[model samples]
Every structure is written in C-alpha cells, then in structure tokens.
Target: MSIVIGDIAKECITVDPSTKCQNVYSMFEEKTALEGIVVVSEEKPIGLVMKTHFFQKLSTKYGFDLFMNRHIDLVMGDELLIVDYSIPITEVSSLAMNRKQENLYDLVIVTKQNHMYGAVSIRELIMKLSELQIRIARYSNPLSGLPGNNVIAETLQEVITYKRFSVFYIDIDSFKFFNDTFGFREGDEIIKETAVIISDTIQTTDNEPSFIGHIGGDDFIAVIPHYHYEELCKEIIFRFDRYIMRFYTEEEIERGYVQGINRQGILDNVPLVSISIAVVHNKQYPITSIEQLSREAAKIKKRCKNITKSTFLALTE
Candidate 1:
C-alpha cells in the first residue's frame, strides 16, 4: 500500500474556538517547539492559529492590552488546509508547497471521516517525499531509465492481484558476445536503444497502462494485456531486429556476425543479438504468487533462447 499522511502525522494540541488569546499564549509557552494549535469545535477542526502570528499580534504596540483578553477567534487564521488522513503523502506535499507564501509554514490538519485525526508538518511531509523519490531512483535502471528488478517484483505482485494479465520476460541473445567485441560504451548504447524500441512499440499499440521494466543489462520484463500479447511481442521483435543492426559495423552487418573471444579464450564468430520473449499469462496458468510467475517465465525463456531466432514462447495449457 502507498504511504499516506497518517503515517507521518503528529499528535497536535487542540483548543476551543472561544479560548482566549492569553490562554493560547500560555500553551505556547509550555511547548516551546509548538508552531501552531488547531481550533476545534465538537472535536472537529475549524481553524488554526500559528504561534508566531498570535505572538506578533500580541507584541504590537498596545496590541497585548487589546486582544490578550479577546477570544482566539479574533486573531485566528481562518484560511487553513484540512486533508484526509488517508491521502497520499506525496499529494499532501504538493498541496502544502502550493500554499500562500506567507502561510506556507502553517500546520496541516488531518481528518478521518469528518473527525479530527491529527496534524502534519510541512517539513516532515517534504522529508517523506524526498525519501520516496530516492527509493524510486534506487530501483530504476540508470542506463535505460526504466524501473529495475525491485520495482519489477512489486509490479508483478500488483498484476497478479488482478488475476488477469500476461507477463513477458524478454532477453537479448548473444548479447555478451556483442559487448565483448564492441566494448562497454557500445554495449550501454545497445541497452539504452533497446529500451527505447520497446517503449516506442508499446506506445504505438493501443494497449493502455502497459508496464515495461528493465531487469538490468539486456533483460527486461513487461506486463501487458492478454488480448494482444502475441501481436505486441511480434512488433517488439520485428522492430528490434530491424533497428539493432544500426549499431553494428558494415562488415558485421553483411557477414551477420561479430568476432569475439569466447569464455574458453578461443577467438570465434558470434551471431548478432536476438530477442527472446517468454510469455506467461494467468488466464492459462494459475499464478498464485510472483515466485511462481518468475520460475515459469525463466523456464520458458530458456526454451525460447534455444530456437536460434528472435521469437516469443508462451505458456500453453
């Protein structure tokens, strides 16, 4: 589940609307770090009063003499933000950042089902947002700018929850040979270009909400609708095969292979890279968990790779 405001909201002090300014000031003096207090009526937050604003009013020339005895409602800030406790922290951060400049430091009141829940500080909200962004970045493949292995597992879990979707585990064949001969820079470019090809092909198709994740290097995973899974796979392989040669030399392109040192230290010719897609759809197989889906896809991927061509193999029955 997504992180919500209630996860970080702090318990706040509340006072009645009829509470005098002098009484509110006393509360502030007791809690030196308290920035604001919620003004509630019948256990529902109605307004907010920032300690600085209240003290400023009291410190004015002859101001204390006039409003010290007056009710806090006389100087309380009415323009306040009240958010549902279940709202996403990221969303709340956006709302807080967009507040009026002068009132930006004000506390945000949180409510649950129309009842006062608590309050959130803008500073805490920002910190949570920053942490979320860092986590996303950490799980993203730097080369392809696509979500990496960690996100792939999470996405698979979510797709499995729906109990109706196809997972395509994609891999590039003979990729290591190309990387060995072409060098790391060229290898990185191929990975980046492959990501673009997959993303672009998916966009051209009318499959909405398609998920494409890179599992680092030359491997990727995609969550697509079951209806058009085969057609989409064909498109990806065709586009990749057509465009992959652009990164190859004229001789390698004409000869259809590149020469590289094999793992056994023997110099030999290696075929150009090809894509292998292993498709597993819950419609045909009952996927109870991400582990089952991954294990099945890996099994199918090995079979697809042995075919010596860019192709996709799907689970049948």
Candidate 2:
C-alpha cells in the first residue's frame, strides 16, 4: 500500500487558545518529547508554538512577568502549515520545500476535514520522503531512472482522486521499425531521447508541476492539471518532431524512411519515427479507473497513429 502523511503523523500536544503561557510552558516541561504544541479553539487549530521560540521569549529579562499570565494565543506563532491527512508524502514534500527558509524546521499540522488530526515535523517529513525516494529508485527504469509501473499506478490513483486532471499517454510511432532497422543501441538512444524531450518540455513550462513516469519501453505517462495538459502536449510533440531526425543517419534522413522486416517477416519501407500522444481528462467524462483511462488512451493513440505525423489527440468527448 502507498504511504500517506497520516501514516507518519504524530499525535499533537494541543493547548486551548485561552490557556495561559505559563500553563503551556508547564505542558512542555512535563512532556519533554513535545517539541511544539498546537493552539486550538473550538476544535480548530488556530496557531502553533515551538519550544525553541517559546523558551526564547521567556528567557528575556522580565519576560515571565509580562507574558506568563497572557493567553497562549497571544504568544503563539502565526498560523501553522495545515495539510490533509490523506495527502501522499511526495506532495507534502513539495509543500514543505516552499515554506520560508527561516521557518523551514517548523511542524506541519495534519488535519481531517477542518479539524486538527496530528502534526509532523520537518525532520520526519524529510526522512519519509527520503525513504520513499529510495524505494522508487529501486523500481525506476534503468535508463531514464524515472518511476516505473508501480509508481505510475500509485500516481495515477492519487491524481484521479482529484477528479479533475489530464492523463497524457505517450508512445513512439514506428518504434519497432526503428529498432529493427537501427541496432538495439540506437533504439535505446531513441527511447532515452524521447524521455528527455518529454521531461524538458514539462520542466520548462510555467504551469504547476506534473507527474511523469515511464511505463516501460516506448510508452510514458504524464498526469497534469487540465489547464496545462494541452499546451504541454503541443510542446512535446513539436519539439520531438523538430529534433528527432538528428539521431538518424544522413541516408535515412534523405530517404525519410527505413527498410525493415514487417511483423509478418515481409520486407517493407517504414516511415521515420514519430510520436503519438493521447490525452484523456475528466472535463467532459467521468474517468473512474486506471484501466478505463488506459483503454481510452490506447484507442485515441491508434487514431493519432493513423495521421502519419507526430501529433496529439485529446479525448474531449
């Protein structure tokens, strides 16, 4: 089973917003393991107080007299980072990275719906992410080092839960022919080159970060926001077409095709390699499962291959 933030979330030591600072300090003193505590009101987490900052304030001369009796909320730090308990650890890592550098070590609050569920420290978040990375690396493709089928299924399930995303199924056209005509080493280069093309296209875009995974061989998958999927696909197909021929020999470039054995072992002239991308989104249809998405994408990809050029087809209907 995939891991989520809730799996590692620690039970938060909490204080009522109306509690005095001295009482909160006592809770910290008694529970030495408590690095921080959430300041909650009406069952909602409103603020956070870290032990280091809390003690720093009390260490100042006359600080105890000034703040000892004040409400905990008055001394609590600004609102804490709140995340849903069900969110995957990978997504949480991204959120953690975007936090202010000064507060980089701050604890993140985990919640179920609007109420506080628990809390997780930056240290724990980093450790979980590191472990996840190691596990994924073991299953990643040997060449591109991208996540493999297991990670792809996990990512797809996570993305579809949002109920609004575009799944781009990417495949190479005439890839078998290219492999048969060229040597296996050259075919490997084409696969790697395709990986670079898709990767660079998505990385350079200003849109929200998307998940890209290798589904093995010439097939890849990208889960992106609906708004950015079309533009991303356009960029990938265009860049691939413009630079793909660079890998071919001068003769092959001039001939614009390769001589290879067809699947039936008959001699045939196959066109140069091109890309076919099929996009399926929940904008118009309710895509319920990974199997359904894959089947639809395969159907659309077949249509794209019929075009005889590098192109993408969106399944809007």
Candidate 3:
C-alpha cells in the first residue's frame, strides 16, 4: 500500500561484495540520476554506496589508484539504514532521523524477507510522510487524532475478507456521566488517555502493527490477528484501571463512585470510568461480511456492558 515505505522507493542497482569498485562507478555514470547502490550477498543487502560519497572517495589523493581496482565492499557503507518493504513510513522516518550525522542523507535500503528490493532517497521519504500526514489530518478524529468513522469503516471492510482476525469494539463505561459532572475539558483528557492506553498496549502485545481506529467519543476499534485476543484484553484492562485513578480526586477514588444523572433521567451514583472490550473473531467461524462482523461484536458489547469495572467479552460460542 501507499502507506508503506517501499511504495515510494526508487529502483537502484545491486552489486555483489566482490564486484570491482570501478564497475560500480560505471553503473553510476550510466544512470546520472541514481543516488545510491545496494551491495548484496546472495540477494541480501550488506551495504549501501551513495554516489556523492563514492565520488568523494575516488577524488581523494591516491583514492582512484587505491579503490578503483578493489572490491566495492572495501568502500561500501556498512552503517547504512535498512528497513522492511512493508514498514510504515512513520517508523522508517524515525529510524532515518536517528542515523549518525554523516549518514543522515544516505538512501535507505528497502528489503523484502532480507532481500534487497530498492532504495528510498531522503527527498522521497519526506514527501511520502507529508502526504500521509495530510491524509490522516483530513480523515482522523479531531479529539483523539485517531482514524475516524470513515477510516474505521474502510478498515473493517478491508479485514472482512481475512481468514483470521479479531475485531475489538472498545467502549468506555460511564463516560457520559463522567463528562457531564467533570466538564468537557476533563472528558477530552480522558478520551486522549484512553487512546494512548489502547494504542500502546496493542503495540507491545503484538508483533505486527495492529489497526486501531477511534469511532468517535468514548469508543474505539482495533483489528488484529486472532491469536492472543484474551491476553490482549486483560492487558488493556490492567493498564486502564491503574491509569484511570489519576483523573479522580483521592476522596472520589476512596469512595469508588461519582454522583451523576442516569440514562433514565434520575440522579444516581455512577461508578468510576472503566473500559470494556468486545472481541469478535473469525478463527473458528466464517465471518463473511462487515454486517456479520458488526452483528457479532454488538452482541458481545451488550454482554460487556453488564460486567463491572474494566473487562473484556469475546464471542466464543
């Protein structure tokens, strides 16, 4: 997808470590616009050679006589940045920013399963990241800055065809009462905190990047591989319970409840804000469409509402 770093990569020549430096120089001469070349062994990238750096080395005193006849690996940059083809531009950009000062402008070697695929210039990486930010700004939720309803719907549709995944419908319990009593400002802080909790927990628990979306106020959604749904749920709850205590006063925390109006229009003592995650997965059942996905998650969410404190309910039977 256009969201990945490889989508913006430029094709570059690959030379084995044993290739002569002069041959690499000739390849650069043939492609005037070429910025770099990847040095590979058995198709796996071992180093990168920037055209400017190569020329600088060759132009040095005795540089031509010394390196022109030697193997390219002798002059190749072993400290280059490399990333998987499917890595997100955001992640790769961070990796690029942290490079040594001298290697800051080097092209990033893009690979698939450790095989050199292409190179991404600094200019191309910047441009693609700018485009991604603009797109997110247009489609993201204003409050949490997570993907909004439209993006969530699209993600759901995309994952509907997957053979195995768990779609989590995350709801904040008693959020309306908390907001009404504490004011919009406090409510906003809670929303942002919740977003961070979900995002961080999922990131730590999963090896691959999980798709998380904000479905507007007090609700979020995440689509991840079917495995470890229960473990993931427990982690989310544990983090939320520990962190949520900070938002309330010591007295209220001690009391374990807040006075607020109920949905039935009567005054009542509403419990402190808690989280509920209703997970619907297709590991055992066939989830044919978005409609089926929503129906199953909705049923689980209803069950989750009846539970107290932070908890998770998964569709198992």
Clashes of each: 0, 0, 0
For model 2, how does the per-residue alpha-carbon lDDT over 1-317 read when each residue is reduced to its tens digit?
Answer: 24678999988888888899989989989989788999888778899999988998999998889999999888898856888887767777778888888567789889988888999998898988889889889989998888899888888877777647888889998888777777789889878888888878764335344777899999998776554577788889888877787777889878878777888899887778989889898888688888888888889987988876788888863
Judging by lDDT, tell me the better candidate of 1 and 3: 3
Worst 10 residues of 1 by lDDT: 201-210
lDDT of 3 by residue, 30-131 (tens): 999988888989988898899999999999999999999999999999997889987877778989999999899999999988888889989999988998
| Model 2 misplacement above 4 A | 1-11, 41-46, 79-88, 95-102, 111-117, 154-162, 200-210, 225-228, 249-268
Candidate 1: C-alpha lDDT: 0.83
Model 1: per-residue lDDT, tens digit, 1-317? 23678888888999998999889989999999999999999989888999889888889999999998989888899988898886767667778889999889899889999999999888878888889778878888988988888878787877787646788888889888878777889888878988998888764435544678898779988876555688888989999898787877899778877777877889887778889989898886578898898889888987987776689998872
Instruction: Report the Cα lDDT for residue 16, model 2.
Output: 88
lDDT (CA) per prediction: 0.83, 0.83, 0.85
For TM-score, candidate 2 versus 3, the one ahead is: 3
TM-score per model over all chains = 0.57, 0.80, 0.88
Ranking by lDDT: 3, 1, 2
Show where candidate 3 strays beyond 4 Å: 161-164, 246-256
Q: Candidate 1, TM-score vs. the true structure? A: 0.57
Kindly report the root-mean-square deviation of model 3 from the true structure over all alpha carbons. 2.6
